[model samples]
Target: MAKHHYKVGQTVSGITKGYTSEGLGILYTEDNSRFFVKGLIDGEEAEAKITYVGQRSSYAKLTKLITKSDKRIQPKCPVSTACGGCQFQHIAYDEQLKIKRGIVENAFRTIAKSDHPVDECVASPMPYYYRNKMQIPLGLDKKGNIISGFYRARTHIIIPTPECVIENERSNGIIATIRALMKSMRIPPYDEDKRSGVIRHILIRTSYYTPGLMVVLITNADNFYSRNNFVKALTKAHPEITTVVQNVNKRKTSVILGKRFRTLYGPGFIEDDILGIRFKISPQSFFQINPLQTENLYKIAIEKAEINNSHTVLDAYCGIGTISLIAARHAKKVIGVEINSRAIRDARSNANRNNIDNVEFYTADASDFMENEAKLGSKYDVVIMDPPRKGSDEKFLNAVLTLEPKKVVYVSCNPGTLARDITLLNKKYEIKSITPVDMFSQTYHVETVVLIERK
Candidate 1:
């Protein structure tokens, strides 16, 4: 409909930033064009090759590095740009924090129409190797050899990342062991084009403070060659593996896990200890990827809720009751609800495992739970909701308003959706404070915690 500033396959040199008072061009091209830049940073006079141009966004790759920014450093991950998992690995860590804060501030400024004073991003204790979980796709590389790594940006091509610094250190070794075993055993990697092969993906979850680790091998079929011996060899190599499960996904879909699962080794799940509460996480359970930041996040949430001995709390979308059990320690009672029955079962088990009698859980949608509670004239002094990236819907927020909780603490993973949700909640609540946490260190994504008061 209109003339575009850049073109695909065109090599542009040192495109200047569309300047703003907040100086928000550290990683993007201009204020108007939503640009996804790789191997390129602002303030560097380098030439980048425009790869893909879309209606609302564009992508560019640095063809040649004429000059480097002052904040750019040698990325720790060997497959930094190839993997596309962490875009900010090259930028200095301190600069990354500032960029994340600015992102949240910008979302609030443009979407929420609120000049909220966002706090400095809370830094992760371990900037590198902080992720407690890793999911790697299994496929044959160009040489027709079995390999496991992350997919390339926007493509299904696999980039071998043996030394990815963001993932847990032990993950690489386990992947290598599996690869070697597959090679020796003549098991082929999954071929997407042919829709043949056995292994599809490998998902690993490691406990932050405990000696529990689980490995899940996603396959296209239930049975494989020498399954018993394979499990034996895998366990012998990595004694830290507490459990191993096999998930079967036969459909030709992009989704990783299927409906059926069979335990090939010890238990079907693993447990992690955080904030003095033990959480049982199954393969499908929605747990935080960064355990170190998750501890800090839960602490910040509980503290911001300002729960007293006399207060009652509601935890919506509570997976495994991480926040509910933590809040139960400070409040008189806590109630948690989720749509996934499996997560509710784990939450109840977690509560009983920790002897937390004050917290209760239900297998129901959060919005429905809130609406029913409002209709029943039940009240909660504080409500803590950790919604998905899309954030909570308006019906849930409206129900929350009817409940009139004195304070609401929202833990958001996506800033854009957080701002949109806040605008809806503004009809009944006023923002008090906002804080960003560096849950994902090397990536552009951020986790934010906001506290609101009923008007």
Candidate 2:
């Protein structure tokens, strides 16, 4: 084994490995040195390069495919590897589901060391057109053409996206219109260094529960020449566009949109009905992108909790009260708590617009609220937590355990953290059901809902 450079021709009989947070891992080599490999799959053998030397493990790169895994497939996107948006697009959807489910299982078994049985993977119903929202970045390509797409995987550089196959047809149409309008107006693109441009990005969202479309233009300033022109063309081209708004992100940052906004067209909001409940989405509020699937997800949570008119429910991390509103119809009282003040305002307004009198909104950190509730000996018959990708923290999880609710519905985007947190609560709670819903298709992300009963 030479130390300076590795011959790409050299072959190593090693199994392709799985990954955790950092990167893929290989089985320990002879002499007990772990090899950290990249651009390879689990249960595969390939010729690799010793890219870098490390204390505990050596980093290697795949040069030749020695053995191919059954899970591998040709990625659909030409720039899949370069673009960071979709992680498992190369793998077949079925294979991707298997790998994701295994990750969830291992997180519980190996990391958390729990005895709960991880169920089979539940795949997405519609792999394409599952995305109702898309935020297209605006920049200039190498050819000096204005580009609008997602950022390349892990870089600040933008990848101009002309066509996105995974989003709804209307979204793709809007993107095309934006591109054509830019070409027509010849609006100069935003320069990251100089911080000057007419447009920054375009956020397109559609509602499965409503017939209307929402288009929000995120720009650096209120330069209304091209934006006004674009809006005219967009609404004229697509009658589905019921609401169009402009978001002013004057601050110097890569964030697409800011809080300050102005309505360009329609009533400042789009109405959507879910589970016999109506919701009005404001520009800044948070709502599930995949509306149809979210209906099922909320239905599952509401059904499993056995919510009744006599039960008092507390919904933590409730964005715009999507769940709390649905739960309100069945529960005696529902309190939706969130840290975003804007979201809280939207939640309250949504409840008011829907004429829901039982549901209330609270602006506070979720974990802090749970801890304080525990200290006050306050108990809720039902508690629903739909945390972000990180899942619930230890303080919140422990506080929830002490509350001893009749049923706890945990909705999570990241299964690894959900499994880990479930293991910690296994001492006081029994795993009743684990249902995985595919909110994001053509992507590796999964939305899992778990029900726990106090033992």
Candidate 3:
């Protein structure tokens, strides 16, 4: 490989041209070589020190800002730069929407090779303090005292934060109370290196539509000494806490939750309403973290689906039947499929609680279920899919193609993978409309809903 033009610790000055999908500012040198600078925005002239040199591009840290962009604003969180949670916190909210829309449009143009016009990104109702869920890792600081907060950018080092701007206010309080109690009780944080200690993580989930909260303590072992007192103290401190659970995760892994759960107080789950449908949310249920944005996203998705009483809908990768139960209200019948059986159980319970008789759920892989349905000559008028960040795979897209649904509404979190899947599906379906939703405000991640029609 050719020698890199920029060396580490060398200072370079340039005007930022654009922002990358990861929210880094891009600046080009005279030779057209690019450097991605963090904590910088587009159209800003800045001096930065090279942090790392790559084959094609270099990474830099912004040192001095000569000219700031009009969209640049002060971030609300004190540790926004180090927390790695919200990448676009410095940008104005309106500019954030524009950037996210550009991200979707660029993905389609570059990955899908389509020049389709994308709608403006729908902004979240609450830009900050919108997240209903929070998972804080427990670790020890240099003083060997208990520290509970988020990990730093791309590393396991904990950044102690008493409050996070994006998390629900109640969740923050819960975290603070837990940290205080852990300190009072002398509960040591789990040592990943030594593989000793007790608490590993603390997960808090707050209800958006109701006055309910679920606190899950993920520990390295099942034994939580003085567990009842812990629950009593937590509930006494925070009356909003409706449920408390202890998840035993003994494995030496990065995953937070475990297979076994023990409920110490109230029911094992909390209930929340989304689009007038009450959902029983357990610690492991895959509900959307941003409830308000989720409502808007689902509304747009259902509108684009154009479901009617005569329509039969297939909701693939349905998590707890959020989309399927919502679609069942308008469609004649809805079938929801997911790989996690626990979510399927919750879906069934949610449907029963809502008294929706037309929806059915299956515990199977989405693609596998679709392939079996195709073999059985199953038919449906509409298909709705809300895939994870990686988006749907080719096998899943092929299975969706085989079903020959008249309309397909794809909900995607990753624009690149969505564009790739759309390119493959475009061979059979015609792209109708694409709408991006700002589910995660102050972050680079954006959710998109696409409508496609049989060609």
> Could you say which candidate leads in lDDT?
3
Worst 10 residues of 3 by lDDT: 1-10
For each candidate, the alpha-carbon lDDT, in order, equals 0.85, 0.78, 0.90
TM-score of each: 0.94, 0.88, 0.98
In order, what is each prediction's RMSD in angstroms? 2.7, 3.3, 1.3
Candidate 1 lDDT, tens digit per residue, 1-455?
Answer: 11286778887555534322222232344433444556555666556677777875565666776776788899887788688587788889898888889889989999999998999999999899988888899888778888788988778998987777988898889999999998988778788999999999999999888888999999988899988899999999999999999999999999999999999999899989887788898999888989888999989998899999999999999988889999999999999999999899999999889999998999998998898999999999999999988899978898988999999999999988899898988978999999999999988889999999998
Clashing pairs in 2: 16-44, 84-153
By TM-score: ranked, best first: 3, 1, 2
111-163 in candidate 3: lDDT tens per residue? Answer: 98988899999989999999999999999889877788888888889999988
> How well is each residue in 1-455 modelled by candidate 2, as lDDT tens digits?
22333333443446655754333546344434445664466777666666666554466666677778887888766766667677666666876666666666666677667657766666666766677788888788788777777777558777666667677778977777777788788776668788887777888878776787899888777766656777888899888899999888878876667878899999878877788777778877678877778787888889989999999999999988999999999999998999999889888888988899998899999999999999999979999999988788999989988888988998888878888888889889988887777677656567778899999
* Alpha-carbon runs more than 4 Å astray in model 2: 1-13, 19-41, 50-62, 423-427
Model 3 misplaced regions, further than 4 Å = 1-3
* Model 3 CA RMSD to the hidden true structure, in angstroms: 1.3
